[model samples]
Target: MTTLPASAFLGGFALTFSLIVSLGAQNLFLLRQGLRREHVGAVVAFCILADILLMAAGVAGIGRLLQAVPGLAAWLTLGGAAFLAWYGYGAAQRAWRGGAGAAAARAAGTPLAATLLQAAAITLLNPHVYLDTVLLVGVAGSALAAEARPLFLAGAGSASLIWFAGLGYGARLLAPLFARPGAWRVLDGAVAAVMLLLAIGLLASLRGSLGIGQQP
Candidate 1:
């Protein structure tokens, strides 16, 4: 039996936590669900499962397949950007209208299946998810000795589990603050801004890839 250094597990945990701690599209959606207190368990579970599967596939060399198909990345990026723009617009409209309390009431009545589907779209459709889990994390895992890969994956998976659980459940602690429509408006506005910024960033990256702004 081979003894893997503790660094493998620690490194994976730290890397994954840092990557996901940011306020990206997935995080925004998760936060919204958490705040709304609707299907939080299902949403968090799906997200954690998705991360584990993606990271595992990446470790198993799926990232190489993705790299071989550059056009797919472009397409995914385009799709993600368009979706973000649309979602951002909806959030902005909600913020402007200021019926968040009512909206939450309505969202509470939303079906679990529908909620899961939305969660799926948000998690699966984002190219950055692939980039982070498949390419970056995957490549990192592949670099490790075979025996160490499991420890790394365990660490990474643990981070996702912990983070999502906290984000989903911890949000209820702010239920009092979110009880106010005004607070919802502020949150929706912030969500809109973050989504739009992320969309713009994706578009910019796509353009750079296409060499659109380079001076000849």
Candidate 2:
């Protein structure tokens, strides 16, 4: 393998961070896990690993193959929208019945397997993740020479690491603020709103796709 300049690594890092820094389903889930102080390490690690694998695959040119498959993206989007709607309804219920005691109980009672499953769904079910990681990042990295691609991947992976680690661990600093039932209610309400909004957006996209396909 040939050595590449530090710019390749920095470019990857900057680009990946820019793409991922937004508060989406995955990031919101991680933030909630971090706040609960339940399996924060496992959740963060899983997210980082998942992101790296997707990025690597993107760099490996699997993005094109995925795009070539008909209806696959739409199917994923449908699944994601349904999951988001269900999750949002759950959050709304929690928000409606806000109580510090209930929140604490939930934090303590949630199973690790279940948490990880939600993490996986939040990460993998969303078509945007594939588009951002595989198509956008992958395409950018592919433009570089073969030797420089690794450096780019390293940079992108580093961004995922730094972002998830900080989001997970740094949430402890807000424990004092979230100590109140009111705070829990507000947070859950916001989460519910965002999740539902995202679900609606996904469904709208699918509708648009269907409309376009139906056109003569």
Candidate 3:
């Protein structure tokens, strides 16, 4: 059995946080839910728990199957890119049409079970999340010295707990701001921009892989 050092734990925390702390669909949805104070605990718990499971699976060599299958990563990247693009476009349209608040309220009205299910679907369906947690994080964890693996995982798990809790609860602090229609437009617009940029970048990378573009 491998154990991790204190330093390894710190390193894992930083690395894991860097990868997961992005403005993706999951984060956006969680934030929206948090702002409305609807199913906030459930959403945060699901995300954090999912992260723990996925990250552990990755570090346990379960993610190695991905490395074995050729072009698997590319296919996932393609799918993720497309999903991000569509999601971003929808967000942009909502923002442009000034319907973000309405949409959010409708979503909030959804049952807790449905909201949890949606959150799970959003995270599990995203190929990028699997790649990041299982493959990338697992591979990195596997590389740790025998004495530092445990600490590393601890650090990574801790980061997930901290980030999800913060993101889910922190949105409430901005409730007053989001209450304003103009603020909704700005917030939605920002979300749209982030999603679009992520999508474009993913697609560009895929294009490069296929030799469709000399420069991405």
- Please tell me which predicted candidate would have the highest TM-score against the true structure: 2
Could you give me the TM-score of model 1 versus the true structure? 0.93
Task: Rank candidates by lDDT, best first.
Answer: 2, 1, 3
Q: If the candidates were sorted by their TM-score against the true structure, best first, what order would they fall in?
A: 2, 1, 3
Query: Please, what are the lDDT tens digits per residue for candidate 1 over residues 44-151?
Result: 999999999999999999999998987998998898888888889988988988875547554656799987887787777688999899989999999999989999
Candidate 2 error regions (>4 Å): 1-3, 212-216
Tens digits of lDDT, candidate 2, 166-204: 999999999999888888788788889988999999999
Candidate 1, poorest ten consecutive residues by summed lDDT = 100-109
Taking every candidate in turn, the Cα RMSD to the unseen true structure, in Å, is 1.9, 2.1, 3.4
Compute each candidate's TM-score over C-alphas: 0.93, 0.94, 0.81
Position 210, candidate 3: lDDT: 81
Compared with the true structure, all predictions reach lDDT values of 0.89, 0.90, 0.81
Candidate with best lDDT: 2
Kindly list the per-residue Cα lDDT of model 3 for residues 127-200, writing each as its tens digit: 77888889888889888776677788899999999999999999899988877777777777887887778778
